[model samples]
Target: MYIAKINIMTKPEILDPQGKAVELGLKNLGISQAQEVRIGKHISLQIDAQNEQDAKEMVENACKNLLANLIMETYQYTLTKL
Candidate 1:
């Protein structure tokens, strides 16, 4: 078995309203030190595969096909044996 940890975020050029809102809220709460805050999604999946390469391919496919929006978002993942 393997585990995949995926992180998906909006492209750098894309506007992130939710991230802006969170930054504003942080500032309102006196967290002025926080700067350029961004929001993203983290996903973990348990996969049964023959090897690391296969598990990685499956995770990448999932990210490209369903998890991240290629037009506005990007993704990265880490795979580990479970």
Candidate 2:
């Protein structure tokens, strides 16, 4: 069996209001060490595949089709044998 871990995030050029809010909140809480905080999505899945190539293909397809919005977001994944 194989497992896939996907991370989806908005492009840097795009504005993230939620992230900004969190950053402001942290500053108010006296956390000055905090830098830019970008919010993103993480997804994990298990797939029945024969090899790493097949598993990677499945993950790519899923990310392209549903897991991420290609227009505004980018996605990366890691596949591991389980």
Candidate 3:
């Protein structure tokens, strides 16, 4: 079995309104040190595969085809064998 951990984030050039809102909220709560609070999604799933390479390919395809928007967002993942 393999476990996939994926992180999806908006492209650096894209504006993150949600992140900005969080940043503002934090500052209002007296957290002035927080800056550029970029929000992202983290996904974890388990896959049954013959090997690491197959699992990796499946995860990559999922990220490219469904999990992330190529134009505005980017994603990266890590796989661990169990």
Candidate 4:
């Protein structure tokens, strides 16, 4: 089996209100050293595939079809044998 770890984030050109809120919260808490906070989703999946290439394709399809919103979000994944 292989494990896939996917990270989905809003496109750089888009504004992230949640991230902005978190950044504001941090500044309010006196953590001013931090800058440019952006929030994202991390997804993990287990695939019963024969090889890494297959696993990658499956993960990519999932990302394209269901996991990420392609219009505003981008996704990246890493597949590891488990």
Candidate 5:
């Protein structure tokens, strides 16, 4: 069995309002040194697969079809054995 970890985030050129909000909150709390913060989504899945290739294919498909919005976001993944 393996665990697949996926991260989805907007492109750097795009504005991140949520991240900005968090930065502001941090500043208000006296962490004024905080420069910038980017927020993204994290997803994890457990799958039974024969090898890393197959597991990677499944993860890529899931990212393209459902896990991410390709129009506005990019995705990266990592697979680990359980």
Candidate 6:
């Protein structure tokens, strides 16, 4: 078995209003130097794969086909043997 850890985030060029809101909220709470806050999603899944490379490929395909939006979001993942 293999475990896949995936992270999905908005593209740098895209605006993240939710992140900005959180930053502003922090500043209001007297948190100085809160430059930026970019939010993202972390997903973990177990795959019945033969090797690390195969697990990575399956996770990448999942991100491309369903998890991450190709136009606005980017994704990366790491595969660990279990």
Best by lDDT: 3
lDDT of 5 by residue, 1-76 (tens): 8999999999999999999999999999999898769999999999799998899889999999998999899999
Report the error of model 6 at residue 56, Å.
1.3
Measured by TM-score, how close is model 2 to the native structure?
0.95
Candidate 4, run of 10 with poorest lDDT = 51-60
Question: What's the TM-score of each model vs. the native?
Answer: 0.96, 0.95, 0.96, 0.96, 0.95, 0.92
Off by over 4 Å in 5: none
lDDT of 2: 0.94
What lDDT does each candidate get? 0.93, 0.94, 0.95, 0.94, 0.93, 0.90
lDDT of 2 by residue, 1-82 (tens): 8999999999999999999999999999999789779999999999999999999889999999989999999998889899
Model 5 worst lDDT window (10 residues): 31-40
Q: Report the lDDT tens digits of candidate 6 across residue range 1-82.
A: 9988999999998989999999999999999688769999999999998887788788888999999998999998888788
Q: In model 5, what is the error at residue 8, expressed in angstroms?
A: 0.6
Question: Of the pair 2 and 5, which is ahead by lDDT?
Answer: 2
lDDT of 4 by residue, 1-82 (tens): 9999999999999999999999999999999888889999999889999989988889989999999999999998888999
What's the distance in Å from true for residue 55, model 5? Answer: 0.3
Superposed on all Cα atoms, model 2 deviates from the true structure by an RMSD in Å of: 0.7
Give RMSD to native, each candidate. 0.7, 0.7, 0.6, 0.7, 0.8, 1.0
Model 4 — TM-score against the truth?
A: 0.96
**Candidate number with the higher lDDT (3 or 6):** 3
Candidate 5: the clashing residue pairs are none
In model 5, the Cα lDDT at residue 8 comes to: 99
